[model samples]
Target: MRTEFDFAPLYRSSIGFDRVFNLLNNAQRLHAIDNWPPYDIVKTGEDDYRITMAVAGFAEGELDVTQERNVLVVKGGRADKQEGEYLHRGIGSQSFERRFELADHVKVETAKLANGLLSIALRREIPEAMKPRQIAISSGLSDQTAPLQIEAEKQVA
Candidate 1:
């Protein structure tokens, strides 16, 4: 089955979003029509994630994982073998391409293959400046101020 997406109305209404619209206009990317060696994307923590792909009959050496231009590309291809006399060949050993879109600041931490599963862990770190900080408020005017506020101001500066 094939699914279709219409973005004409969205594009028409969108203003000052040329970059976004251009990305969406890429039909090839907007529609991912292939699913081989199904995978899963799981969020393990507030800033951590994991992508697990079911890569049965695929060896660790046969698969390759790389991040380029913020896109995670997973590719698999089996080594060629000489044809032998066989009555049946049920299992398939074919090449496949799987792509994933990543958010800004997200990066692949590590990749491991175990128990027929290819798992890639990702982590996004929040910069110290971007992290949430508590602000202390004074109840009344006093000659001496709260130590926390002084520390906060120093950090900000």
Candidate 2:
């Protein structure tokens, strides 16, 4: 049994949080459950991250990694060309697609496949104008300053 949530009230009051609401809505609408090609996400540094997916039977050219805006997609599959019939098949290389949601300013650094594990590096590079900075305050002129007088010579008409 699945229950649908009403986010209209939340959207009416929130500001600048459309992404968060969309993520929540998408999570609720998942019809099929997929557990194949397991993956792990780890935080390596303060602004660095890594995603590792186990793709045992897939070759180097069978996988693809793409980043569109704030979404990271990884797909793996290959055509089957086996000669003999398999009695007991355990290693499955069926087509599988996985998606990951990334935060703003996060970008893909590198992707490498080694030992049946596909590792994707991600780094969050915030722009200089968006970073926080301290402002210096100084004391200068005041409103209580007196006016200056100018000396003038007497002239006959």
Candidate 3:
């Protein structure tokens, strides 16, 4: 059974959070995705993250990772034909694709495949212009610093 959530209440109070609500709605509606390959998302640092996936039968050359807008996509497949017949195939050699939603300013740093595991690194880099800055406040009436002067003596100096 699937349950639907109403976001109308949150829309009126929240500002600039439409993307987050949209992602939540889409996740609840999507039900056809397969869980063949297991994965894990971990936060390694304050602004850094890592995604590790198990790809036992896949190699580095068979996997593809891409980032479009705020979404990261990972796909893996193998075209090599198996010559021998298997009585019971349970290694999960089928092709699979997985997508991850990234927040603003989040970027992929690197990807490494080792010991049948694929690990992807991510970091959030906020721009200098967007960072918080301190403003200097002047209480003394200096002619050079102040725009307008109330006394003529201060302006002449």
- Candidate number with greatest TM-score: 2
TM-score of each: 0.68, 0.84, 0.82
- Residues 1-157 of candidate 1: C-alpha lDDT, one tens digit per residue: 7555676788788787765655556644555557678889999999999999989889988999999966899999998685987698766678998877776678999999998889999998777898899998866655476566443434544
Local accuracy by lDDT, each model: 0.82, 0.92, 0.92
Clash counts per candidate, in order, are 0, 0, 0
Across 1-157, the per-residue lDDT of candidate 3 in tens digits comes to 7789999999999999999999999898888668868999999999999999999979888999999999999999999687898899878888989999999999999999999999999999999999999998876655456476586555544
Writing each residue's lDDT as its tens digit, candidate 2 over 50-78 gives 99999998998999999999999999879
Q: Which stretches of candidate 1 lie over 4 Å from their true place?
A: 1-32, 135-157
How far is 18's C-alpha from truth in model 3 (Å)? Answer: 2.7
The parts of candidate 3 lying over 4 Å away from their true place are: 12-15, 140-157
The number of residue pairs in model 2 that clash at the backbone is: 0
Provide the lowest-lDDT 10-residue window in model 3: 148-157
